[model samples]
Structures are given as structure tokens and as C-alpha cells.
Target: MIRVVILGAGNIAQHLYTVFTKSEAIQVVQVYNRSQKALQSFTNVATTTRLKELRDADVYIIAVADDAIASVANKLPFTNRLVVHTSGSASMHVLHKKNRRGVFYPLQTFTKGKEVDFSQIPLCLEAREKTDFKVLQQLADAIGSPSYKISSEQRRALHVSAVFVNNFSNHLYRIAHEICEANNVPFQILHPLIQETAHKITTLTPYMAQTGPAKRGDQKTIDDHLEKLDKDIHKEIYTLLTQSIAKTYGREKL
Candidate 1:
């Protein structure tokens, strides 16, 4: 079995620990955190507050915040071992040069209490050595996740695109929620449209799936939307997105 020591007790770390423990091909030997309190949730595995006391493992997975990853890696007692971090934007080179470095980024937004299906989540991996890449691929396979060998530059681009698709899209949903609230309409009314939009993208390219006034260059409808928006920020967002959509369809004059 592939032995792993997970460092950090945050959402991603907790989720990885849970999934790894369930896989017969992998074993989470220990979990480390800066404090013992965060380590309490990892009931089945060994836990440690002291980095120097970390046991030897085949791979050390640092699932901490992007900023803290380097600090944790630099403090590790040993060197030249396989070490990987779970970050999309942070380059694998951010890990101190003392160890064999790699990335094991899961391309999905993780929530603390929500369970994620590993099979559907994409695992983006990178390694300095080919053998280390295989190890990460094996770990991804053990967790039933699809794996991709991506360079740091490519991963950074993907991270930015992910922000546009996932984070920005979620914020739009929040804005819709606020609009519904102001109008005294149940936000649930938009649930089917939301689901349909997500479902459409699976079968059709986003450009092909695009619809509505902006795509059609319906200036009257666009103006109506901007005028109806109660907040200036909302109006600005509407105008900017509409202009973007219009530009995408070669209707810049609209």
C-alpha cells in the first residue's frame, strides 16, 4: 500500500484523509497540524503537532493554505523524500528544494461538511520526476479520481479559468438570490434554470449554449435589465457582462 502523511486539518486535508482511508491501495499513516485541536477529527490515524515527530511515509501531502504550504514544507525534518502540495495556483517549486517536489491539486471547490464524489473530481498532478508522477497518478487512481499531468504554468491557467467558471458563476447565483429576495420571489424558482444551464454545458459548448438578449444584441432588453437593477454594483455587473456577451458574438456596436 502507498503510505501518506497528510499535513493540515483544513477542508481539503480532511476530505483527502477520508477518501484515502477508504482506499485499499493507500494508507494515511499520520496527519499533522500546527495544533492538536484541529487534529482531533482525524480519529483513526496518528496525529502530531510537532513536525519533527512526523513518521517516515512514502509521500507527504501538504494540504494547507497556499501561503502556508512553503512554511510547512521548509520545516519538515527530513529531505529528498517525495513531497507534494494540494494547490492549484502555487507552483510545485514553492516547496523547499530539500525534497522531491510535486503537486496533487484536486480541481474542485471543497466544502467543509459536504462530501465529494472522487470519481467526478479531476486531479491535476505535476512532478519533477517521472516516477513521482506515477505515484501521484496511483494515489489519484486509488481514490477513483481522473488524473492529468499538468505543468505549473498550465495549472496556473486552469486555476484562473476555474475561478471564472466556478467562483464567478457562484457569485452570479448569489446575485440572483439577492434579486429574488428583493422581488419577494422564492429563489427556488431559479433552481431549474440553474440546473438546466449546468446540464447544457455538459452537452454543448458554452458559446453554442449562449442565449438571451445580450447574445441577440437586444439593446432594449439589456437597457431594461440595467435600469431594473437596484444596486449600482449590480447594474455595473449587468452592463459589463452584457458587453462581454455582445463582444463574443461580434456585436460590439450594440
Candidate 2:
């Protein structure tokens, strides 16, 4: 069995802990956080607020924030064990070399109370050593997650793409919701379109899935949208995206 000690109590930490516990091949020996209060939810497993009291384990998964990763790894009392972080933007080198470093980035946005299917999340794995990479793969396999062997450089590129697809797109949804609220329209009315847009990418490339006034270079419709928007920020975003879509389709004006 692979023993893992998760070192944070945040969203990623909680989700990883939940999935790891449900796997028969992996055992969460202990959970460590800066304070005991956050560790309250991990009742069945051993937990500590102090690093010095950490138990020896096969893997130490540092599921903390990007800035705090090095601090936690540097403070660890042990060395040469497999140490990995659950960050997409941060490089694996962020983990102190005192321990073998790896990355276990799950390419999905995690929320505190949301329960996601572990099998649906892809695990982005990177390690300094080939053996360490295998260990991470084993952990991924235990959770039934599809694993990818991504180098740090490739992982960095992937992370940026993820931001564009996940983060930026989510922000657009927020903007749409705000517009809906201002117009006194039910946001749920747009839910089907949102779901269809997401599903279209499964069979068609985004470039091929394009369909809108901007894609058709309908300047009148574009102007109408800009004029309808009440906020300057929303107008700016609309214009920018319209320009982008037009440019993608080789349309000089929209």
C-alpha cells in the first residue's frame, strides 16, 4: 500500500484526502495543516498542526497554495522521500530538493463543498526521477484517474491553457449572469446554451464550433450588443471577444 500524508486543509487537500481514503491501495496516514481547526473534517485519520510531529510516509502530498508550497516543504523534518504538490501554475521545482519532488496537478477547478468524480479528472504528473513518476502514476491509478506524464515545461504551458479554458471562461459566465440580473432575465434561460457550447467541443474543435454575430461579421448586431451593455467593462469585454472571434475567422471588421 502507498502511504500518503496530505499537508494542507484547503479545497485541493480535502478532495485529495477524500479520494485517497476511498482507495484500497493508498492509506492517508496523517494530515498536517498550520492549525488544528482546519483539520477538523479529517476525523478518521491522524492529523497535526506541527510539521515536526509528522509521521513517516511513502508520499508527502503538499496540497497548499502556490506561495506556501516551498515554505511547507522546507519545514518538513524528513528528506529524500517522495514529495509532490497539487498546483497547476507553480513548477515542481517549487518543492524543496531536500525531498524528491513531483507534481500531482488535477486539471480541474475545485470548490469546497462540490463533490467531483475523481475518475473524470485528469492527473498531470511530473517528477525529477523516473521512479518517483511511477509512484505518482500508481496513486493516480488507485483513484481511477487518467494520468499524463507532463514535463515541467509542458505542464507550465498546459496550466496557462487551463487558465484560458477554465478560469477565463468562468469569468465570462459571471459577466453573463450579471447582464442577466440587470435585464431582469432568468439566468437559467442561458443554461442550455452554456451546456451546448461546452458539449460541442467534444466532437468539434472550438474553431469549427464558432457561431455568432461576430463570427459572421455582423457589425450591426455587434453594435447593438455594445449599445445594450450598461457597464463600460462589459462593453469592453464584448468588443474584445468580438474582435477575437472576427479575427479568428479572417473577418477584418465586426
The best candidate by lDDT is 1
How far off is residue 111 in model 1, in Å?
0.6
> Model 1, 1-254: lDDT tens per residue?
99999999999999999999999999999999998899888997899999999999999999999999999999999999999999999999999999999999999999999999999999999999999999999999999999998999999999999999999999999999999999999999999999999999999999999999999989998888888899999988898998899999999987
Name the runs in model 1 displaced over 4 angstroms.
Answer: none
Give the TM-score (vs. native) of candidate 2: 0.98
**What digit string (tens of lDDT, one per residue) describes model 2 on residues 194-252?**
99999999999999999999998888888898899999999998998899988999996
True lDDT of residue 73, candidate 2: 89
Top of the candidates by TM-score? 1
Estimated TM-score for each candidate: 0.99, 0.98
**Residue 117 of model 1, lDDT score:** 99
lDDT of each: 0.95, 0.93
